[model samples]
Target: MMGLLLSLLSGLIFGAGLAISGMADPARVQAFLDIFGAWDPTLAFVMGGALIPMAIAWKLRKGMKKPLAAGAFDLPGTRQIDKKLALGALFFGVGWGISGLCPGPALADLAIAPGPAAIFIGAMLGGMALHKITVE
Candidate 1:
């Protein structure tokens, strides 16, 4: 129950941040992503804004015994830059560049345009399914 509440609050805050930053609009996100033609550095600042809190949380987590509930520092162990990592990043970048919608931003934008959101989400899920089947 507590975790569910926290999750909802977190999502609300995330959506609020996206809306406030104008990232919920695909055009704004696209403009921010467009570095070659008409570049916008708004996203850099937004990213930096998010990073500050994340850095603080990372430092705080290091000192804590465990999280508020369960799980003890469940961080990724692999630091190796392998083909899988590179390929995943490449695909993610291509998707973001073409659609101006990363996972978080895409979810946030769903409130405005359900059609594209539904299609994009379906494609995303399909990719996940394909990856799972192929990886196995």
Candidate 2:
């Protein structure tokens, strides 16, 4: 129950951050991506703001035996730069560049604009399902 509560709280914080940071708007994201055409650097500030807390969490995690909300630290074991990782990153970047909506912000937009958000989420899920069937 505690773990579930923590998860919910974490998600709410993340969603609220996305909404407040204007990341939930595809137009803002696309403008940030548009380097040669009316580029907006606001997202860079948001990314920098996020990195500060994440960097601190990573530094703290190095000394922790277990996460506060979990029995053990379930960190990724791999540090390899393999084909699969590279290809996955490429696909993710391409999708983000094309749609201007990564998964988190896209999910956050669902409450504001249901129709397009649903379509994007549906397509994303379909891609994930396809990847699962093909790869795993």
Candidate 3:
């Protein structure tokens, strides 16, 4: 119960951050990715800002025995760059480049622009289902 509540709180905080940082705006993300054209460096700064807290969290995780709301620290055990990973990354990059939206911001955009966001989310889920059927 606590873990679920914590997860909800964490998600809300993350979504709020995405909204406040203008990450929910697809045009802003597209502009940021447009390095060859009228490039926007705001996303770079947002990423840089995110790194600070991420770094701190990484450092803190080393000393922690368990998470606050969970029984154990559930972290990724693998660090290998396999074929599946590469292919997935390529697809993700292509999708992001074309749509200017990723999972996090796309979810956040649901409140702001439901039409586009819902379409993106639907496609994303479809892709996931297809991947599960074919790959996994």
Candidate 4:
């Protein structure tokens, strides 16, 4: 129950941050990606701002025995850059470039613009399902 509550709280905070930072807007995100055209660097500041807390968390994780709401810190155990990693990154980059929205922003946009967000979320879920069926 505690973990569930913590998860919800964390999600809410993340979603709120996305909304507040204007990350939830596809046009703004697309502008940020448009370096060759009408580029926007505002999102860069937002990304940089996020690194502060994450850097602190990474440092703190070095000394942690367990998470506050979980039995263990389920960190990624791999450091190798394999074919799978490269292919996945390529796909992610292509998708982000085309759609101007990734999973986090897409999910956050659900409340602001349900139509487009729903379409993107549905396609994302379908892709995940396809990956599970074929890969795992």
Candidate 5:
């Protein structure tokens, strides 16, 4: 119950941030991805802000043998750059560029513009289904 409550609170906070930052709008994200045209760089700052916490996590996970929450490490130690990762990233970029919606922001938009968000999320789930069928 405690973990569930905390998860719900964190999700709410994240959704609120996405909504307030105008990132929940697909048009805004599409504008950000418009590199050759009238590019909006506002989301770049948001991405930069996110990098700080990501860097901290990277450093800490490198040193820590065990995670604080579960009292055991849940991270991989490999720093290997590989082909599968590159292809996955390319696919993710294509999907994002085409739809202008990432997973979290899509969830936030679901309450407002249901159509695009719903289609994006449904396709995401279908992709997940395909992944599970192939991989595991």
Candidate 6:
């Protein structure tokens, strides 16, 4: 129950940050990506803002035995740069560049911009399903 509450709270905070930072707007994100056009650099500040606390958390986690809400830290096991990882990242970047809606922002946009967000989310889920079906 406590873990679930913490998860919900964390998600709410993240979604709120996305919404407040104008990241929930596809146009804003697209503008940020549009170099040589009417480009916006506000997202860089958002990224930097998010990175500070995350970096602190990571640094703090190194000295901790367990998380406050969980029994143990479930960190990623691998640090390798392999083909599958690279290809997945490339696909994600392409999708984001084209749609201007990555998962977090897309999900945050659902309440405000339902139509396009739904379409993007549906397509994203379809891609995930396709990957599950095709990949090992």
Alpha-carbon TM-score of each model against the true structure: 0.90, 0.94, 0.93, 0.95, 0.87, 0.92
lDDT of 3 by residue, 1-136 (tens): 9889988998899999999878879999889999999999998998999899999999999999997788998877899999988999999999898888999999999998999999999999999999899976
Report the poorest 10 consecutive residues by lDDT, candidate 2: 111-120
Q: How accurate is candidate 1 locally (lDDT)?
A: 0.83
Q: Cα deviation of 34 in candidate 1 (Å)?
A: 1.9
Question: Which regions in candidate 5 have their CA more than 4 angstroms from the true location?
Answer: 58-68
Off by over 4 Å in 6: none
Clashing pairs for model 4 are none
Q: Note the clash tally of each candidate.
A: 0, 0, 0, 0, 0, 0
Candidate 1 residue pairs in backbone clash: none
Score candidate 1 by TM-score against the native. 0.90
Give the better candidate number (4 or 6) by TM-score. Answer: 4
Model 6 lowest lDDT segment of ten: 14-23
lDDT of 6 by residue, 63-126 (tens): 9999999999997799999998999999998889889999988888887888999999999999
Pairs with backbone N, CA or C atoms under 3 Å apart (clashes), candidate 6: none
What 10-residue stretch in candidate 1 is worst by lDDT? Answer: 67-76
The lDDT of model 2 is 0.89
Local lDDT at 64 for model 3: 94
Q: Could you tell me how far off, in angstroms, the CA of residue 110 lies in candidate 2 after the best superposition? A: 0.6
Write down the lDDT of every candidate, Cα atoms only: 0.83, 0.89, 0.91, 0.91, 0.88, 0.90
Extract clashing residue pairs from model 5. Answer: none
> How many clashes does the backbone of model 1 have?
0
TM-score winner between 1 and 2, please give it: 2
Name the lDDT value of residue 28 in candidate 1. 70
* Overall local distance difference test of candidate 4: 0.91
